[model samples]
Every structure is written in C-alpha cells, then in structure tokens.
Target: MYCFTDPWYLPVDLKLIKSIFQKDFSYFNDHGMYCHPKDNISMNLFNLVNEDWKNLRAKLTPLFSSSKLKSMFQIFVDKAEVLEEVIGSYSSRNEPLNIEDVASRFTIDVITSCGFGIETNALKNSNKEFMKCGVETFNPRLLKFVLMEVVPSGILANLGFKANGAHTNNLFNNLISEVIQYRETNKVFRNDFLQLLLELKQNQEMTDDQIIAQCFGFFAAGFETTSITVMFAMLELALNQEIQNKLRDKIEEVLEKYDGNVCYDAVMEMNYLDKVLNETLRKYPPGPIIPRNCTKTYRVPETDVIIEKGTRVIIPIWGLHRDPEFYPDPEQFNPENFNAENKANRPDMAFIPFGEGPRMCIGLRFGLLETKLALIKLLKNFKYTLNGRTKVPIEIDPEAIFTLKIKEDVWLDVTKI
Candidate 1:
C-alpha cells in the first residue's frame, strides 16, 4: 500500500507477520515513526529505535514486575471506588452515564496517582489541568499525522514542528520537574513509577529529559488505552446481558475466596474475566494496526520479493483479528471465542491486541490490571444496560489516528445492584 510516495508493506500472512514481529525482528526493529530530536516527550520507549529503546526498556522492566504491580494494586482499587461513587450519583438521578467520559476520568486519576505519585482527583473535578492536557495530547489532527508520516523528523524539527502541542509539553515538563524537586527537597519516598525513575536518575542510569519523556509516555499511553478497553468492555457487556451476568457471577465467586475484597490475587483468579477481556480486545483493539520499520534489506521467506531497508511494514492487526478464518462469525462479541479449546485452535499471532515479541507494549500487565479492576468494581456493584442514546451499532471514529474509538459517546443506564 502506498500513502502518497511512501510505500508500506501491509502483510496479512500470519507467518510473515510473526517473523516481522519476532524471528526476523533484527530487520524490522524500529516503529519507523517520526520523532524530532527537539521533541523530548516524543523520544519515549514507544518511539525510540534500536539501542535507545533496548536500554530504556531494560531499566523500566523491573518497575512493572509482578511485585511492583501488586504494590500499585491499591491505587487501582482506590480510584475505582471513586469511579463507583461518580457512577452511583448518576444512578440515583436516573441519568444515563457517558461511560467513556467517566472511564476516561477514572483512568486519568489512576495513572496520575500511580505514575506521578500525585492525586489529580480527576473523577471528582473533571476540569483539572491533567484532564485538559490529556484531551489535547490525543486530539487527532489528520494534517499533522500525514505531515509526520511523509516528512523527515529532522526537517520537522528544523521547521519548529513538534509531536505534541506547546501546552502538553510545558505542563508535563513543569509538573514532573516540580514533583521531582519536591520529592528531593522533602526526602520523600513513594512506591510509584516516579520514585523508581528518580532512583534510576540518582544512579545516573537515566537523564532528566529521558525521565520526563517516560513519565509523559506513561501517562499518554496508560490512561487512554486502558480507559478505551474499559469503555468497550462495558459497552459489550451491556449489549450482551448474559455475558455480563456471567462475568459478575465469576467476580463475586472469586471475591468470596478473598473475604469479599477485590485484591490482586482475587482479580487474577477470575479466569472468565480474562476471557471476556481477551474477546473485547479481539473485537476492539486499542491499537488496530502495528507499524514497524525495516532496518535492513530482507527477502521474503519462500519467495523472491526482497523488502528493502527503510521500507515500512504495516501488520494489519484489525484485519487479522476480524478475519473469518481465525474467528468464525467474526462480528460476534462472544467471550467463548477465547476459551481454552477455541484459543488453542487459532494461530498464536492471530490474537495480538498488544503486538507480539520484544517491541510489544511494555505496560500490558499494568493496563490489563487497571482495566480488569475497573470492570470488576463497576459490574459487581451495578447493573448496566445500553441506553437509547448509544447507536445500536456503534461507529468507529474515522479520524482516530492512534487508538480505536467510537464515534458516538457510549451511554449506559445504570442501576445499583
């Protein structure tokens, strides 16, 4: 496929996709996205290529380990409780809730608290600066996206073009600097991502700009992707009452084992919830496409076609996910599609909401834990149904460049169970 003069190889073959992501990763290691040297926030792990990505990933990997996430689990529960209160107010008034907006706020609070070690109280106060910054950061401008793709990063940097707006860059820069300064001055220590980053900085393993860029990337990636997953999961559950009820039952059953507390272990015990989340990801992956850059000339396995270095590779994740060959009745929102037997029958690469191999999303576990906690909190306490305001068949926003988003707000009628 050609976008203007730039050619992209859209590979639909699963075997080739696997090789691109894993086996032949050395040839396709970079994402090929433009990142201006002037844009510090854009130089995150997601955008960095080769050694930069590798070093940063190695340093940050420990911060998201099982013990680390368990330590952060309480943050998820606390924010989810706030989310429950916000939803309860709407349920009391018999008002339908725009779940996407509410979930976005919930995730904002969670990410801020967990990642920045600060409380933005986004759920209670929707007009917070963090909320505004998040909205602006992700606002899809088609022209900007196209220019970034077609133009070179150095040229863009020379022309004073950045990946993010001035407001976003300034807010994150100032906010992170203030927090780091305060923590150092007070000798404060917190078991959060920022604290870990500070330790890395103290050890001279990371520079100030790298730390700021990572914090920005953590917020930018963490909140929206998890919130989108929560929103879509709720939408699907509302549309499929039986699945919703069954999932709630599983949640309750698992919580019972933990004395009715929604702990890390209890959430992990809910295998059915995993299946539901997997199915939701399959149907509405946050990132519908995976982009990779060919770093070296590579010949197609068992073919004469030679993909030149610098060629862009587009792994059509959405197309493969919805293909009828892998998923019979591809349009159906059935959790059973992810059950042990069914999943075993499908190819491993067929289900990649998070891209496969090394460059896959680093925050996969954190994202899933946050998303599952939100669903458990909401479903265990309330019964939700699709409100009339939501379109019967939701439409995907054509302008959503980065993530999968519904064109219309997802409104659901909620009643306290």
Candidate 2:
C-alpha cells in the first residue's frame, strides 16, 4: 500500500504478520514509534529501541510473574471492593451508570496501586489530579497524535514538539520521587513494581529518570486497555442475557468451592470467564494495529519481494479479527468461539490483541488478571442492561489514535442481583 506515495506495507494474512513480527523480527527491531531519551515519560518499552527494549524487558519480566502478581492480589481485591461499593450506590439510585467513566476510575486505581505502590482512590475521588492527568496523557490531541505518529521522533524533538504531555510527566515524576523518598527515608520495604524498579536501580545504577519513566509508562499503558475491555465485556453481557446469567452462575458456583470468596485462584479457574475474555479481546482488541519499522533489508520467504530497510510494516489486527474466514459471523459476541474445540481449530496468529511473538505486550498477564477480577466482582453483585442512553452500534472515536474505545459514554442500567 502507498500512503502519501510512501511505500507502506499492510500485511493482511496471519502468516505474513507472523513472518514480519517473528521470522523477520531481526529486520524489524524497533516499533517505528520513537521516544526521545530526554523525554522520560516517553522512554517506555513501547518506544524503546531494539537492545534497550530487550534489556529492560528482561529486567521488568520478573515484576509480572505469577508470584509477583499474587503478592499484589490484595491490592486488586481492595480496589474491586471499592468498585463494588461505588456500583452498589449507583444500583441503589436506579440510574444509568456511565461504564466508561466508572471503569476508567476502577482501572486507574488498579494501575496506580501497582505502579505507584500506594492506595489510590480514583473510584471515590474521580476528579483526583492524577486521574485527570492520566486521562489527558492518553487522550492525545490531534496535533499531538500527528506529531508523534506522523512525524519522525527526531524531527519532532528538534522542533521542540512533545507528543507526550510535559504536565503529565511532571505530575508522575513528582509523585514517584515523593514516594521513593518516603520509602527510603522510612526504610520501608514493600513488594510492588516500584520496589522492583528501585532494586534494579540500586544494582544497575539506573538513573531516577529511567525508573520514573517506566513507572509512568506502567501507569499510562495499563489503565485504558483494561477499562475498555471491561466496558465492552459488560456491554456484551448486557445484550446477551443468557451469557450474563450463565457467567453469573459460573462465578457463584466457583466462588462456592472457594468458600464464597473471590480469590485470585478462583478467578483464574473460571473457564467461562476466560472464554468470555478471549472473545471480548477478539472482537474489541485494545490495540487494533501492530507497527514495526523494518531495520534491515529482508526478502520475503517464498517470494521475490524485498522490503527495504526503513520501510514501515503494519499488521492490521482489526481486519483480521473481523474477517469471516477466521470467525464466522464475526460481529457475534459469542464466547463459544473461544471454547477449547473452536480455539484449537483456528490459526494461532488469527488473534493478535496483544500483538505476537517477542514484542507482544509484557503487561498481558496483569491486564488479563485485572479484567477477570473486575468481571467476577461486578457480576457477583450486580446485573447490567443496555440503557436507552447507550448508542447502539457504538462508534469508535477517530480521536483515539492508539486505542479502541467508544467515542462517547457507554451507559447501562444497574441493578443489584
């Protein structure tokens, strides 16, 4: 494909995507999205160069391990409990709840807890400064989007244009610095992502900016994706009562085996929830495109085509996910499609919600865990129905350059079950 006469490669076939993303990974080491090192908030795994991404990924890999996730389980549960209370109030009011806004608050609290190592009350105090700052950070204006995605990072930096908000960076940096100083001054140790980064700093002598940049990345990247997942999942359940009731029954039954408590183990073991999540991701992947910059000349396998270095590659996830060949009745919100039998029948790369191969989302585990927990808790107590206020055939916001979300609010009527 040609974009403004520039040779742009849009790989439609799953095999082609796998080839570019995996087989020829060496030729496409960078994401094509660059973050100037001087811009601390932008120097995350998503924007880091080849070697930098690899090393930092290895260091941060341990933070998302099962053990590490379990250690942070209470933080999620605590936040979910708050979420439950907030929802209960809405249910009592017999009013429509804005799932997008509410879900954003829920995820913001979770990400802040994990990233900042502090209990954040975004659920209670929706107008919190950090919450607002986080929203602005991800909700890039048109100019910012053009500057970051269209223009080269080097050019943008030279022009003194920052795609990332300096206000957002300062807020996050100040927050991290304050917390780190408190932890150091009090000689208090805790098991969290920040603590892990702190240890890495001590051993590797990483700059404070480096650590803060990652923490800021963790906060910025984690929140919206999970929020969108929950919003869509709930919307699907609202529209499909049978699925909702069945899922609720499964949740109740599973919680019974675990003493009626929604623990990490029980949540993880809910097979139906897993299927629903898989189906949701298939239909509404947070990131609908995977991007990479070809760093070396690479000959296409079994073909005479040669992609020159510096050529950009785009893996169109939306097209693939919606393709009827891979998913019959692609628009249907059926969790059955993700059942073991059906899943086994499909090609591995047919679903690339979190991308594929080595460059896949490192935060996938934590993100899934958070989504599952939220669904378990939300459905355990309340039921939702698509309200009149909700626009059917939800439209995607063209403004959301990087994520998939409704342009406006997702409204649903809530009732305590």
Candidate 3:
C-alpha cells in the first residue's frame, strides 16, 4: 500500500524517509506538532511550523554551537557532582534507587542551570517550586497531548483551547521573566544558554513569550530525552554486567587524566562512553517516531507514488532503529554495535537517534554531553545491579508511544565503590 487509510502517511521506503528529512527538504519543513498564539506557553520550537519556525530557530541556533557548548560545560559538570551526592544517599540507605526518578532530578537541575542563570538545585531539594512546574510541563495532560499532536492546532486556538493550564503557564512565565530581569539589572552574566537567549532579546525582534517558549522548550525536549536516555542506558548496564564493567574501567582510566574531574575534555575523550550511549539510543530512541507535515506535494524519487501537501508523515524511527537487516540481532543491548568499524558498516540514516534533517534536534549535542557526563560520574563512583522492584525484560509505557517511557521504575541496587 502506498498510503494508510488513517490520517497519517508512511514513507515505506527508507530512501523516502531520507527524502522527507533532507532530500526534499522544502516539502517537509515542519515536524507537525502544533502550537497556538492563544497559548504563549504552547508556542515553542517543537510545535512551530514553516516561517515562524525558521525565524525563531535561526536566532537560537548559533548559541548551541561547539564553542558555546564549551563555555557551558562547567555547569553540567557541577550537576554531575550533585547527581553523585544525591544518588550516594540512596546507596547508603540500601534502598532500591528508582533511576527514572533520580535521572529526572538530574535533568531538571541541568535545565534550570542552563535555562536560567541560577541553579534551582532540583537534585538537592526535591520540593523546589520550579521542580513542580518542570514536572507539570513534561507530564503533559492526555487531552492536551492529543490536541497538540493529533488535532489541528489552528482549530484548537480558534476554539480557545491551549496545551497548558494558565496556572502552570504563569509559573514558568513568571520564573523565567524574573530570572532574566534580575540578571540584566544586576549585571549578572553567566556562560549558559540563558545568557544567549538574553542576548537575542537585544535584537528587538525577540519577545518575552518567545524567550520563555525557548527556555521551556529546552526542558520539554531536553528533560525527558536526556533523562530517559540515561534510564535506558542504566537499565541496559544493569542487565549487561560485562558491558557495564568494561565501560566503568574505561571511565576510571580517563578520569585519572583529569585528576578524577568529569570535565568536558575528559568525557569527550572516552570513546567507550560514546559507543555505549549510541547503542542505548539505538535500542530505545528518545523520540520513537519523527512526525512531519508535508507542506507541499511531492513524489517519491524513482517511483510514481505521490504524497499530497498538508499530509502528515510519520517516520518510524523506532522500527528503523531495530530493523534486523540494518542491525544484526537488533534486540540485544550491545555497545559493540556502535564500535567504529561496525558503525561504518551500516547505513548512516539507519542510526538516526536524533531525527535526520534541518529540523532535527539541535539540542541533541547538549543531551549527549550531559548524559555521558552523568554516566561518567556514576560509573566512576558506584556500581549498579538490578533490584527486585524492576520488571525484567523491560517494556515501554503504552501512553508513551511517541517517547520511550518505562511503565515501572527502573529500580537498581546502587553500591558505592
């Protein structure tokens, strides 16, 4: 079948998937997740389409460049330390550590530190107000999720509907606005993403709501993507002890060069960590499906199949990531699958944990750096094993069909080494 009877269309051929992402770029600029002007909180990069997306994304892109990442590396290093101290307590209690919970805490602080100039210390203080808002932001409402993802956003906006509640939206708006204002008034400058966004505001083209949307957008995309990636990576490590030990050994050797500091330089040098993260993303990609709206009529290259404009395309990233033909023994959690020689042996598009194309996640670089740094700190200081509370042979939450969300806590017994 060239198309499905449902509202979505599937590009059955892998080449068509690439075509949608990169080859026929003009035809599919939007990811199809919608936003409305009525809900300023709903107006984020992930939901934007066409010109609005292009304009806003252009302003934010340069800030995430390589040089900029280097300037912000220390903030991530500090959070890694907090992760160690926080998780250490769980080890001392001899309690089964819920990695899903702990990992969320780590990413929350990362978002606060990176998005705002101040550290909310979410990992250290669980009851911080920002923590509550952060949770409310990510744990999206069921109806809102359907409306934002399934229904046309213009219709919802026309009917006076929004993706987030006013109370929750106000909290984020007030928090980010206050932080930026305080920074400007006090001449408090920080080498972080927030500073970059603040600088963009000087252009006179960026508005407070746009800035707020971007800050919240970082959390929306970064929070679950980074945290869940870590959770799945840890879960895999717990089940595959041999692979875990090998990675730990590599971490120890590298940290010694940095005097045991989990610095950007040190983490980047750890080739094994990259392999491990690559493998985890392969088995359980953060965004399982790449959703895109066909903005113009297009025909598949070398085929007569025509996809009409305004059609929604679902790129089955999860299916492609696990295709046995591309990845031999696709079910196993093996880091060697990402080994230099092995990776080169496979097609480049086959391993797109981050969606392929101009609209692909730019924050993926920061996500990878943060995740690898977290693993570096954890593995170097402690050891983990599967706890009784965890379900064996893991499964994703049905509700989290778009993103990989485990139904149960990926509880692990942590032992300080």
Largest lDDT belongs to which candidate? 1
Cα lDDT tens digits, model 2, 150-207, are 6877787777665566678678778889998898789778878888888887897466
Candidate 2 minimal-lDDT segment of 10 residues: 160-169
Name the weakest run of 10 consecutive residues (lDDT summed) in model 1. Answer: 131-140
Q: TM-score-based ranking, best first?
A: 1, 2, 3
**Which model, 2 or 3, shows the larger lDDT?**
2
Candidate with more favorable, higher lDDT: 1 or 2:
1
What TM-score number comes out for model 1? 0.98
Residue 360, candidate 2: Cα error in Å is 0.7
Among these predictions, the greatest TM-score belongs to 1
RMSD of each: 1.2, 1.6, 2.2
Which residue segments of model 2 deviate by more than 4 Å? 149-151
How high is the lDDT of residue 369 in model 1?
A: 92
- Deviation in Å, model 1, residue 22 alpha carbon: 0.7
* Candidate 3: worst-modelled 10 consecutive residues by lDDT: 1-10
- State model 3's lDDT: 0.82
For 79-123, candidate 1 gives per-residue lDDT tens digits of 999988988999999999999889999998989889988888889
How many residue pairs clash (N, CA or C atoms closer than 3 angstroms) in each of the candidate models, in the order given? 0, 0, 0
Per-candidate TM-score against the hidden true structure: 0.98, 0.96, 0.94
- Per-residue lDDT of candidate 3, residues 247-331 (tens digit): 9999889989999877778888999999999999999998888888889998878878787887888888889989998888999
